[model samples]
Every structure is written in structure tokens, then in C-alpha cells.
Target chain A: MIETSHLSFTIGDSQILRDVSLSILPGVVTGLIGPNGAGKSTLLHCLAGLTEPSSGHVRIDGQDPFTARDDDRARMVAFLQQSPTTVSRLRVEELVAFGRWPHHRGRPGPEDAEQVAKALDAFDLEELAGRPIETLSGGQKQRAFVAMTYAQDTPWILLDEPLNALDPRHARNLMARLATLANEEGRSIAVVLHDINAAARWADQIVAMKDGQVLAHGASRDVLTSDTLYACFDTPFDTVPHAGRKLVVAT
Target chain B: MRPWVGIGLVLIVMILASLAVGAASISDGDGGWLIWVSRFPRTAAALLAGAGLALAGVVIQNVVQNRLVEPTLTGTPEAAMLGLLGVTLIAPGLAVAGKMLIAAGCALLGMVGFLALARRISPRDPMLLPIVGLIYGGILGAIATYVAWQTDLMQFLGIWQLGEFSAVMQGRYEWLWAVAALAFGLYLIADRITILGLGETQARSLGLGYEQTRAIGLVIVSVLTAIVLVTVGAFPFVGLVAPNLASRWQGDNLRANLPIIALGGAMLVLGADIIGRLIVYPYEIPAATLVAILGAGVFLWLLHAAPRRA
Candidate 1:
């Protein structure tokens, strides 16, 4: 479980996160959604231990991420930040292998190789394994990076906008992958997402934020309502039943 | 069959040429004295400086996450020159090692200053950094030049500013062996250095101590720059051109590619030094001049090739 208690973060005079307390349950997919400047990214950074909050405390699996050594924190939590560096000249497989760094550090054994190969196969990146990341298209590149995050083999996986460059099909495919990882593997997953319908379809829980505060947080069915969406995004939102599920659309 | 094997052969030939071809040619029965005293030291200095500068280039480029920026462009060499000038004026009786420490310190400060300035620029655009480096380096160089002029130490400045090995001898150039030691130390942590290219958040996520690794790289670059400047003077683009060529041929697997980059740098400098010696036939053009011309060409090609290569 990743828990933040009464968290407030400020950069100089501008506050990025307010007195926000949130609980992210283990073995579930939690989708974080809001408009721009919603503090979703900041909160993710805090959870990842890449940022220290000005006030309040963050505990990941009962230990403070801030105080844990970088390697130990990485062993426990794998975070993919928004727009992570698109390194050129590195083949897809080698890039994914970097996820194993926290495990082997530099000396890679047979087990590390097995994990890397498993990660590549899991993400269906076996075909592009030898290809350089720069040569891949947007969706393929996004898949490669997601595969790297998967390769981290951490119990908690936090991704900030993993679907930015992906097309609709790829985005749905990625969400399906995350949902499977959370449901079947029992790993906790938190993702910052822009697509409301994807969150509605795939996420078990949802957190809606606006102006640096959590406006709504609960199970998807409870929190992903038209009123909550409208309140969070400052726009008119309509939720209509489509087939067996509800679709969130801005009017 | 491997590229490095071919490069090794080429390097050997270059070393032989460097030792054999000089202003004072060795006669049949010279008994290795000239080779040990002058030619050997000069050849070794060239190789060490080239390798050192190349690794420095790799570190700076990875740290900044831009291929175009190198130590010379980062105000390091200019700062070292300024430090050396200060030492010359204030404490002429100080030891060479003392002067080097001061210069290395100044180079680190200069690099930190540039890094702070770099924080302001949008890092997404890689081209902007080289321009910023050039301007920042130019301002530093101008200040150094003005200081040298005021102090009438322009001749002293030229010896350190324009890198050449004609004056190299055994006892004088032995300190350059530090480059070899530094390069070996860099090899051990090359993976961490490579991780730096991933940018801060990703690198840290990968369990790298991002600030610590970056600090280590900057210190190494500063020390290497100061060592080269104080020992055999400054060479412009050994760091830039060597690492780019290695990356182009071998890719960004820096742990495995470190030797290739170092050797690539050594070859370029050794080759340039030979050409400099042979082109003027004993009169000798500065290896610095030749390398600047060649390095600038490679740099321009890199700028033109960045978008196309991707």
C-alpha cells in the first residue's frame, strides 16, 4: 500500500499539492485523472520518492520512500515519469534490460536475463527487441518503455501519462495489460491518465483532483460520476450507459 | 575481424610513427635514450591526453544529455587557463601539482556555473546547448585573454592555451600518467555514467544515485581537463569527436564502449600530432590547430547529422 497523509508540496510560493491525503490499495489499478495542473504528476513523483513533500509523510509498503536507499526504493517501487528520456541508439531489448539494474546493479546473471526475456515477451516486444528505440513508431516506442517499467519487477508500478503518444488501439491495449497485471499478478498499479473512458473501463479505483486537491476518491463506479468529472475538469461532463459499461464524455 | 582489432593495429602503427618520426631522428645506434627521454614521453602524453579528453567528453555529454557539449565548450579549459594564470602571477614558486589542484577547482566551479545556466534553457532542444556552451565558453575565454593581456603573460598563456607536445620530456610529462589512472577509475563506474543519459528521474528510478554520479563525473572531467591543460596544454575536440565516433560505430552501451571511445580519441590525437609534425617537417604546426580544424568538421557533421541519424 502507498499512503500519503496530509501531504502539501510547494515550489517557492506556488503550491503544487495541497493538504491531500490519499490511500492507494495494493493489488488494484488506480487511475488518477484531472485537468492540466491537477497535481497528479507531483503526487506520483512524491510516491516514487523522486520528490520530497514540504509537509506530511509518504509511506510505501510501511517504509518511508524518502529515507530508503535508492536501490531499496527501486526494488520496492518502479516509476515511469512523464515523457521519460527517449534515448537513441539503444536497442529495445537493451533498454528494457536497464530495468534490471536495481537488481544486479551491473553484474547480470542468468536469472536477470530470464526476467528481461520474460518482460519482453509479456509486452509482446519480442519482435522489436533488436530494433533501436528511435526507429520505432510512437505506439511501439511507448510499448517498449512500458515493457521496461514492467521489467522492473516491483510490487508497485507507477506510470505518469504512459499513453501520451499512443493511438487509441495501443492505449486500450496498454490499459488492458496494466489491468491484467493488477488483477492476476496482484501488483498495485497507479497511472496518471487523460482518457476518462479508459479509466472508467479498466481502473478498479479512481482519484479525481483539481486545484491541487483531491475532489473525489473511491471505487470507479462511485467516484467516476458525471458530477465528479465536471467538478474536477471544470467542464460539463455526461456519463451515458454504453452496452454493459458507462462512457464519460465532455459536453 | 573486429573493429577494435583493426583500430589496435592502426594505433600501434601510429605509436611507432610517433616514436620514430620527430624533429630529432634516432640514428642506428642511439641506444634507446632519445626514444625514452623525448619520443616515448611525447607519444605517451598524446595517447593519455587523447584518452582523457575523450572520456571527459563522454561524461559531459551524458551528464548534460546532449551530444554536442564537451569540456572545451563547457568553460572548463578556459577556467583552468585562468586558474593557471592566477597561480603564475601570485605564486610563481608554487609546485606544479599545487597549481593543478587550484586549476581543477576553478574548472569545477566553472562547470557548475555552466550547469546552473543550462538549467534555465529548455533541454528538449539539443541544439541550444552547444550555442549556450559556446557563448559561455567565449565569455570565459575573453576574460582569460583580457587577464593575460593585462598581466603581459600572453606568451605564458599561449603555451597552456594552444596544446602541443614538442616540449614534452620524461620527467615533465610523467604526471600525464594520471589520465590513465583516472580513465581506469572511470571504467569501473561506466554503467552509472551511462545511466545518467537516461535523465534524472529515470536514472534515479533505475537505482542510480543521480546527484552523486553526476558530481563524480563533473569532478573527473574537471580533473582531466586540468591535467591535460597543465601537462600538454589544451586540445579542442578530442573529447567531442572521439565519443561521437565511438557511439556511432558501437552505440550508447557506454560500459562496453568506454575503451573504444578512449582509443578512438587516442588515435585521432596521435594521428593529428603525426600530421602536424609531418606537414611542416620539423617546424611543426600545433596539434591543437589541426585537431580544432578536424574536430570542428566532425562537430558540424554531427550537428547536421543529429536529425538525419534519428
Candidate 2:
């Protein structure tokens, strides 16, 4: 379980996240949705222990993420920032294998290798395992990063705007993969997304925020209603049933 | 066999040629004695300086995560020269080891200042960091020039500015052996250095102490540059060319490629020195000038050739 209580983050003179309080259950995808500059990314960073909140608490699985050792924190949560990259020509397998570092430190045993192979297979990256990551297309690169995160074997996975450059087909495939990871492997995922429909189709729950505060928090069906989205985005939105789920549209 | 083995054999051949191709006459009867005293040390100095500067370049490039920037471009050599100038004026009687220690300290300071400026730069523009470093280095070089002129140590400054191996002797060039130890130490932690090229957030996410690793890399670069400067003046482009060429062949699995980069550097500098000796015969050119011209060509080629992200 991931929980934040009265979490507030202030940078210099501006307050980025204010008095945010929420709990995320394991084994489900939680979509963090808001308009631009709505503190969604900042809240995700605080939850991942990458940034400290000014005057509140963040706890993952009953432990303080900020105070835990790096080894312990990495084991508990795997956080992938937006489009993280390296200059060196690391092959896909090598990059994914580094996810096992916190576990084996440096020396790799059979189980670690097994997990790496499995991650590559899971992401369908076996064909590209030997290729340099820089040579891959953007969607392929994003999939490689996701494969790396999955190889971490952490209970909680946090991602920030991972679908930005991906086309719709790649986006759907990636989201479906995350949902499978949540449902089958029992990983808790929190993804910051700009597209409301992607979140509506794949996310089990939604955390809506506006101007640095949570506007609504519930199941996707309840939190993604037309009224709630308008309140969150300050724009009119219409919800219509499509393919057994609602598609959010601008009006 | 690995490609570097072939490169290594060629390097050995070049070392032999450098041993045979000095200004000494073939009729000089004591060739063996000259080998023990002059030729051996001079050849060794070229190889060691080349390896050290090249290794220093790899370290800084990884630390800053930019291939275009290296120790010489990043105010390191100029900063070491400034420290040497300071010691020459204040304590002219100091030992070479003592001068090297002070020079290392000043080089570290200069690198720190350049890193601070680099932080404000957006990494999207790969050209910016090295350009900033060039300007930073130029400013420090100007300061060193002014100091040397004021103290009438311009002659010493000139020698340090343009490196050559004509004066290396057994006793004079032993200081560069520290680089071998430094390179060995770097190899032991090559994995950590490789992680540095991943930028801050990813490195930290992988449970690396990012700042600490960068600190260690910068210190090694400074010490390595200072040692080379104190021993054989300065060599340009040794750092930039060798590692890059090595990478183009073998990927950046740094642990596996560290030796290749070092050897490539060793061969390049030794070859340059030999060419310098033969260019004008008994009236030899400085290896630094030759490398500067060659390195500038490679630099331009790197900038415009295919425009891959460095």
C-alpha cells in the first residue's frame, strides 16, 4: 500500500503540492490525472521519494520512503522518470539487466539472469536485446525502459508521462502491458497521464487534481465523470459510452 | 584476437621506431647506453602521457555525459599551469612532487568552477558544454600567460604550453608512472563510471551515489591531468580522439573498453612524437603543435560527420 497524508511540497516561493492525502491499493493501476501544471508530476516524485515534501508524510507499505536505505527503497518501489536516457551505447539487455543491480549489487546469479530474460520476453524486446538503445525508435525506447522497470521486481512502480511521444497503438499496447503487470503479477502502478481516455480505458482508479490539490479520488467510473473532469480541468467535458467504457470528449 | 591486440602490436613497433628515430647518429657507438638513459625514458613518457590524457578524457566525458568535452577543454590543463606558475613564483625551490600536489589542487578548483557553469546549460545542445569549457580554458590560459610574463617565467610557461619529448631522461620522467596506478584504480570501478553517463536521475534511481561518483571521477581527472602536465608539459586531443575511436568500434561497456582507450591514446601520442622528430629532422617540431592541428581536424570531423548525437 502507498499512502500520503497532508503532503505538501514547496519550491522557493511557489507551492507545488498542497495538503495532498491519498492511499493507493496494491494490484491495480492508479491513474494520476490533471491539467498542465497541476502538480501531478511533483506529487508522483514525492511519492517515489525522489523529492521531499515540505510538511507532510509519504509512506509506502508502512515504511517511510525518504528514511529508508537506498537498497530498501529500490526494492520497495521502482520509479522511471520521463524519458530517462544515457549517452553510452548500452545494449537493451544490458540496460534492462541493470534493474537487477539493487538485488545482486554487482554480481549476478542465475535467478537475476532469469528475471532479465523474462522481462525482455514480457516486453517483446528479445529481438532488440542486442541492439543499442539509442538506435531504437521512441516507442521501442519507452518499452525498453518499461522492461527495465519490470525487471526491478518491485511491488510499486511509478512512471511520469511515459506515453508522451508514443503513437496511439504503442500507447495502448504499453498501457495494456502495465495493466497485465498489475492484474497478474500483483504490481501497484501509478502513472501520470495527459490523455484522459487512456486512463479511463485502462485505469481501475483515478486521482484527480487541480492547482496542487486533489479534486476527486475514486473508481474510474466515479472520478472521471463529466462534472469531475470539468472541475479538475476548468473546461467542459462530455462522457459518451464507447466499447463498453466511456470516452471523454471536449465540448 | 581482439582488434586492440593488433593495435598493441603496431604500438610496440612504433615504440621501437621512436627508440631508433631520434636526432642521434647511427654511428654513435653506445646505442645500448643511450637506450637505457635517453631513448627509453622519452618513449615511455610519450606512451604514459598519451594513456593518461586519454583516460582523463573518458572520465570527464562520462561525468559530464558529453563526448565533446575533455579535461584540456574543461580548464584542467590551464588550471594546472596556473598552479605551477604560482609555485614557481612563491617557492621556486619546491620539489616536483610538491608542485604536482599544488597543481592538482588548482586543477580540481578549475574543474569545479567549470562544472558549476555546466549545470546551467541544457544538455540538449551537445556542443554547448565543450564550447563553454573552451572559453573557460581560454580565460585561465590568459591568466597564466599574464602571471608568467609578470614574473619573467614565460620561457617555462612556453615549455608547458607546447609539449615535446626531446628532453625526457630516466630521472626526469618517472613522475608519470603514477598514471598507471590511476588507470588500474579506474578499471576496478569502471562500472560506476559507466553509470555516470546515464545522467543524474537514472544513476540515483539505480542506487548509485551520483554526486559521490562524479566527485571521484573529477578528482581522478584533475590528478591525472596534473601529473601529465608536471611531467611532460601538455598534450592536446589525446583524450578526445582515442576514446571516441575506441567507442566507434567497441560499444561503451567501459570495463571492457578501458584498456583499448588507454592503448589507443598511448599509440597516438607516441606516433605523433615520432612524426614530430622526423618532420624537421635534427630541428624537431613540438608534438603538442602537431597534435593540436590533427586534433582540430578530428574535432571538426566529429562535429559535422553524419551529426550523430555525441
Candidate 3:
């Protein structure tokens, strides 16, 4: 479990994240939804221990992630930033293999290769394994990055705007894969998503934010209500049930 | 692999030709002692300097996350020159080693400054970093030039500015051997260096001490540049050309590509030196001038070549 207590982040004179406390449970897909500049990405970075909170603390499995050793933090949380830069001429398989770095630290063992191969297969990247990441299409590159994060084999996986470049098909496929990983492999995933309908349909829980503070956090059905959506986005949103899942639409 | 074999053969021919063609022909009866004293040392100096600069280029590129920028373009050589000028004026009696230590320290400081500036700019325009570096180097070079002129050390400055192997002798160039040890150390951490090219967040998330690794890389680059500047002066373009060619032929897997990059650097510099020897036949031009001419051409070609893969 990942928990934050009165977390706040400030940069110079501006407050990016206000005092916010939340819990991310294991074995579930939690979606973070907010408008632009709502501190969704900053919050995600804080949880990944990539950014330090100004006045509060975050704990992952009872250990402070901000203060943990690098290897220990990496073993517990894997983070995929939005639009992660690619190293030129780095092959897809090699990129995925880097996910095992915390485990091997440069020297790879048989288990590392096995995990890398499994990640490639999981993301359907086998055909593009030997290709350079720069040569892949946007969707393919996104898949390669997702596979790299998956190969980290961490208990908590955090992604910021991973679906930005993905097409609808690839986006749905990725959400399904994350759901399966959460359900079967028991990984806790917190993904910052721009697409509210996708979050409503796939996310086990939803956290709504606006102006650096959480407005609502609960089961998808409870948090996806039109009133909460309006309070979070300052825009009217209609939520309807479709095939036993809530579908959110701008109205 | 076959192409590499071909390149190896070409390099061997060039080395032999460089050893044979000099002010004094190796066909002379006294050629054995002359080759041992001057020709071999000169060749070794050129090779080591080339390999070191090329390796330094790769590390700097990865650390800065910019392919177009190298130490030569990034004010490193000029900063080292300034340090050398300072030591020359303050402690003219200092040994070459002392001078090198001071120069390396200054170069490290300059690189850190460049990196700090680089952090503020976006890497979206690949050409921007090199341009910034060129201007930075120019300002430093102007300061060094003013100091040299004021101190009446312009003659020494000229020699440092135009890197050449003509002055290298058995005892004069042994300090460059430090580059070999530095390169070996870099190889041991090649994987970490490659990981660094992934940028800050990913590298940190992968458990790398990103700032620490960048500092170590800068130190290596500074030391390498200092050694070369102290020994052969500044040879522009070898660092940029060698690593760029190697990356095009192979990939960015540092461990797998470093040897090839080193060899390519050695060959290019040695080839330039040989051409300098034979082009005028005993009235030799400086190898540094020849490399600048060739390196500039290649650098231009690289700029106009196909769009970058990244």
C-alpha cells in the first residue's frame, strides 16, 4: 500500500500541490483525472518518489519512499513519466532489459533475460524487439516504454499520461493489460489519465483533483457522478451506465 | 565484421606509413634509433590523444543528452588553455603534471557550468547546444588569447592552439598514458553511462545516482581533455567525428562500441598526421590544421545529413 499524509509541494513562490492525503491500495487500478495544470503529474511524481514533498511524507509498504535507498525504492515502485525520452539507437529489447537494472545493477543473470522476454511478450513487442526505439511508431514506442516499466516487476507501478500518443485500440489494450496485471499479478497501478470515459470503464477506483487538491476519491461508480465531475473539472459531465460500467461524457 | 577487418587493415597501413614518412626517412641507416626516439612516440601520442578525445566525446554526449555537443565545442579545451596560461604565469617553474592537474580542475569547472546552462534549454533543437558551446568556447578562447598576449606567452599559446605530434618524443609524451587507464575505468562503467543517456528521471528510477554519474563522467571528460591539451594541444573534430561515425556504424551500446570508436579516432588522427607529413614532404603542416580542415567538412556533412534517428 502507498499512503501520503498532508502532502504538499511548492516551487519557488507557487504551490503545485496543496496539503493532500490519499491512499492507493494494492491489487487495483486507480485512475487520477483532472484538467490541465491540476497537479496530476506532480502528484504522480511525488508518489513515485521522483519529487520531494515540501511539508508532508509518503510511505510505501510502511517505508518512506523519499528516504529509501535507490535500489530499495526502485524495487518497490516503477515510474513511467509522460513522454519519456529515448536513447538514440537503443534497441527495444535492450530498453526493456534496462528495467532489470535495479536487480542486476549492470551484470545480468538468466532471470533478468527471462523477465525481459516476458515483458516483450506481454506488450506484444516481440516482432519489434530488435528494432531501434526511434524507428518505432508512436503507439509502438508507447508499448515499448510500458513494457520497460512492466519489466521492473515492482509492486507499485505509476504512469503519467501514458496514453497520450496511443491510439484508441492501443489505449484500450494497455488498460486491459494493466487491469490484468493488477488482478493476477497483484500490482498496484496509479495512472494519470486525460480520458475520463476510459478511466470510468477500466479503473477500479477514481481520484478527482482540481487546483492541486483532491475533490473526490472512492469506487468508480461513486466518484464518477456528474456532480463530482463538474466540481473537479468546472465543466458539465454526464455519467451513464453502459454494460454495467459507468461511461463519462462531456455534456 | 568484415568492414571492421577492412578498417583495421587500412589503419595498419596508415600507421606504418606515418612511421616511415617523416622529416628523416626511416630508410636511413640511423632510422632504428630515430624511430624509437621520435617516430614511435609521435605515433603513440597521436593515437592515444585521438582515442581519448573520442571516448570523452561519447561520455559527454551521453551525460548532456545531446549528440552534437562534445568537449571541444563545449569550452573544455579553451578552459584548459586558460588554466594552463594561469599556471604558466603564476608558477612558471611548475612541472607538466602540476599544470595538467590545474588544467583538469578548470576544465571540470567549465563543464559543470555548461551543464548547468544546458539544463535550462530544451533538447528539441539538436543544433542549439553545439551553437551555444561554440560561443562559450569562443569566449573562453578569447580570454586565453588575451592572457597569452599580455604575458608574452603567445608562442606557447600558438603551439597549444594548433595540436600536432611533430614535437612528441619518447620522454615528452608519456603522461598521455593516463588516458588509457581512464578509458579502461570508463569501460567498467559503460553500462551506467549508457543508462545515463536515458535522461534524468528514467535513469534515477532505475536506481542510478544520476548527479553522481554525471559528475564522474564530467571528471573523466575533463581529465581526458586536459591530458590531450597538455600533450598535443587541442585537436578539434576527432572527438565529434569518431563517436558519430561509430554510433552510425554500430549503436549506442557503449561497451560494445567503445573499442570501435577508439580505433576509429586513432585512425582518423593518424591518417591526418600522415597526410600532413606527405602533403608537403618534409615542410609539414600541423596535424591539428589538417584534422580541422577534414573534421570541419565531416561536421558540416553530419549537420546536413539525414534527420537524426531520435
Candidate 4:
């Protein structure tokens, strides 16, 4: 389980997150939805130990994730930043192999290579393994990066704006993969998604935020209501039932 | 186009040409012993220094994650030049090895200082770091030029400025071999250095000590720059050109490209040296001048040929 206790953050003169507290359970897909500049990414960064909080603390499985060793933290939580800085000139396989760095350091044995191969297969990247990352299309590159994060094999995966450059097909495929990982593999995933319906249809839990604070958070059944959506984004939303589930439609 | 194969072919051709041409051309050997003692070492010096400079440039580019970075442009070569100047002034009779040692030490210090300044300003901006380095290089070059002019050491400094393999003979060229060995050490640690190119956060998350690897890379660059300074003075952008060429084929995996880049560097220097010798005959232009002209032309071509991201 991942827990954040009164975690607050400020940069320069602006407060990005304020005394926010939340707990995420295992085997659930937690969707973080918020308006622009709502501190969703910032909070994600803090949880992944990419940035230090101003006060309070974040813990993953009872250990301060921020201060934990790289290998330990990597094993517990895998973080995929929005628009990850790609290392150009590297092959897709080589980039994926880096996900195993925390485990193998520089020397890779047969087992590590096997895991890399599995990740490539899992993300449908085997065909593009030898191709340089720079040669891939935007969607392909995003898949390569996702494959890398998946190759890390952490129990809790955190992604920020993962669907930005992906097309509908790729986006839906990725969400399905995440859903499968959550249900079959019994792992937790926290994703900051822009598509409300995608979240409503796939996410087991939803946490809404506006202006650096949580507006509403609960099971998808309660959190995906039109009132909560409007309050979170300051825009009107209509709800419709589809396949016996709530789908939020923007007005 | 496989850059490694191209570089190897060029290096081989240059090696053959270097052995064949000189003041005492292989066709008419004034003394067999003279060729062995003098010309052979000079050729070796050019080859070693060229390879070292190229490898150093590759490492620096990877560390700073910028293509524009080079030892001469990054202030290290100028700092080394100053070290040579200081040694010449303080101990006029100092041997070439002593001068190179002083140059290496000073270059290391200069590189460290530059990195510290870069970190303070903007660690993430690749362009900013190289600009600061270029400015620093200019200041050091100015100081060296002024001092050389005042002390009537202008001719000596000028010869150093326009790199020539003529100064290198068997006995005087051992320093370059040491530099080549240092370059090999860099190759051994190339993986660690490449990891650093991924930015600090990513590198650290991968269990690498970013600061330490960066420092080690800088130190290696300093030593390479210093050796090149003492061996052939300053040679425009062989360092810049070779690595980019290597990257075109090898894709930034330093370990895979090390030999290719080294050979490419050797080919560039030797070919320039040979062309200089052939064009002017008895009145040879400096090898450094030829390198500048050739390197710039090739660099322009690379600008067109370079892949978008590599």
C-alpha cells in the first residue's frame, strides 16, 4: 500500500500541493483527474520520490519512499514521468534494458536479458527491438517507454499523462493493458488521465483534484458523477450508463 | 554508410601514407636509422594524439549531453596551453613530459571548475553549458596569446597553435602513447559515462553516482586534452568531428564506438598531415591548419547527413 500523510509541496512562491493526504490500496487502478495546474503531476512526482515534499511524508509499504535506496524503491514503485526525456540514438531494446539497471547495475546476466525480452513481448515491441528509438513514431516511442517501465517489474506503477501523444487505438490498448495488470497480476496503478470516460470505464478508484487539493475521491461509482466532474474541472459534464457502468460526457 | 568501416579504411590509408612520405621520403632514405628514430615516432605521435583527442571529445559530449562540446572549445585545451606556458616560463629547460604533466593537471582543474559553473547555472540546458565553456576557452586563449607575445615566445606558441607532426620524434613522442593508454581507460568506463547522458535523476535512479562519473569523465578529458596539446599543439575539431561521425553509425553506445571513434580520429589527423605534407612539399603547412579546413568541411557535410536525433 502507498500512503501520503499531509504531504505538501511548494516551488518558488507558488504552492503546488497543500497538506494532501491519501492512501492507495493494492490490486486497484486509481485514476487521478484534475484541471490544469491542479498539482496532480506534482503529487505524483512526490509519491514516486522524484521530488521532495515541503512537509509531511509519503510511504510505500511502511518505508519512506523518498529516502529509500534506488533498488528498493524501484522494486516497490515504478514511475513513468509525463513526456519522459528520451535517450536518443539508443535502440528500443537497449532503452528497455535500462529498466533492469537497478537490479543489474551495468553487468547484465541471462536472467535480466530474459526479463527485457518478456517486456518487449508484453508491449508488442519485439518487431521494433533493434530499431533506434529516434526512428519510431510518437505512439511507438510511447509504447517503448511504457515497455521500459513495465520491464522494471514493480508492484505499484505510477504514470503521469501517459496518453498525451497516443492515438485512440494505442490509448485504449494501453488502458486495457493496465487494467489487465491490475486485475490479473494483483498490482496497483495510479494514472493521471485526461480522458474522463477512459478513467470511469477502467479505473476502480478515482481521485479528483482542483487547484492543488482533492475535490472528491471514492469508488468510481460515486466519484464519476456529473456534479463531482463539474466541481473538479469547472466545466459541465453529463453522465450516461454504458454496459452497466457510468460514463461521463462533457457538455 | 557504416562509419566504422569508413574510419578504418581511412586510418589504414593514412598510416600507409605517413610511412611513405616525409622530408626524407621513404623512396630516398638519407639514413635508415634516421627514419626509424625520427619519422616513425612523429607518425606515432600524430596517430595517438589524434585518437586520444577524438575519444576525449566523445566522452565529454556524452557527459554534457551536447554535440557542440570539444576540449579546445570547452576551455580545457586553453588551460593546458597555459600550463605549457607556465612551465616554459618557470622552468625553461623542462622536458616535454614535465610540460605535459603540468598541462594535464591544469586542464583537469579547469574542467572541474567549468563543470561546477555549469551545475550552478543550469544543469539541464545543454546549450548553456557549452556556451559557458566556449567563453571560458576564449579567455584562457587570450591570456596565453598575450603572454606568448610579451615574452617573444610567440613563434613557439604559434607552432603549437598550428599543430605539426614535425616536432614529434621517437624519444619526444612517448607522452602521446601515455595519452592513448588513458583513452583506453576511458573506453573501459564508457558505459558508466553513457548512463550519465540520461540526466541526473534517471542516472541516479539507475544506481549510478552521477557526480562521481561526471568528475571522472572530466578528468579523462583533461588528460586527453593535455596530451594532445603537448604532442601536436591545438588541432581544430578532430575531437568534435570524429565522435559525431561515430555516433552516426554506432548510436551513442560509447563502448561500441570507442575503437571506431579512435580510428576515425587517427584517420582525420594523419590524412590532414599527409595532405599538408604533399600540398606544400618542402614548405609544409601546419597539420592543425589542414585539420581545421578538412574538419569544418566534413562537419558541414555531417550537418546535412546527420540523422535527426543522433
> Which candidate wins on DockQ?
3
Runs of candidate 2 exceeding 4 Å displacement: B25-27, B306-308
- C-alpha TM-scores of all predictions: 0.98, 0.96, 0.98, 0.88
lDDT string, candidate 1, A129-185, tens digits: 988777788888888888888898999999999989988999989999999999889
Residues A197-248, model 3: lDDT tens digits = 8899889998899999999998999999999999998999898889999888
The Cα error of candidate 3 at residue A28, in Å, is: 1.1
**Docking category for candidate 2?**
medium
lDDT of each residue in A140-226, candidate 4, tens digit only: 988998888888888888889899899999999999999998999887899999899889888999889988998888899899888
Candidate 2 vs. true structure, TM-score: 0.96
Off by over 4 Å in 1: A86-88, B28-31, B308-310
Per residue, candidate 2 scores C-alpha lDDT tens digits across A1-251 of 89999999898999889899999888899999999989999999888887889989999999998898877888888888888777777789988988887788778899999999999999999999999888899899999988988898999999999898899999999999999999998899999999999999999989999989999998998898999998999999999988877899999
In CAPRI terms, model 4 is classed as acceptable
lDDT of 4 at A183: 92
Quality of model 4 by C-alpha lDDT: 0.81
Give the C-alpha miss distance for residue A178 in model 3, angstroms.
1.2
> Distance from true position, residue A89, model 1, in Å?
2.9
DockQ of each: 0.67, 0.70, 0.71, 0.39
| Model 3 alpha-carbon miss at residue B36, Å | 0.5
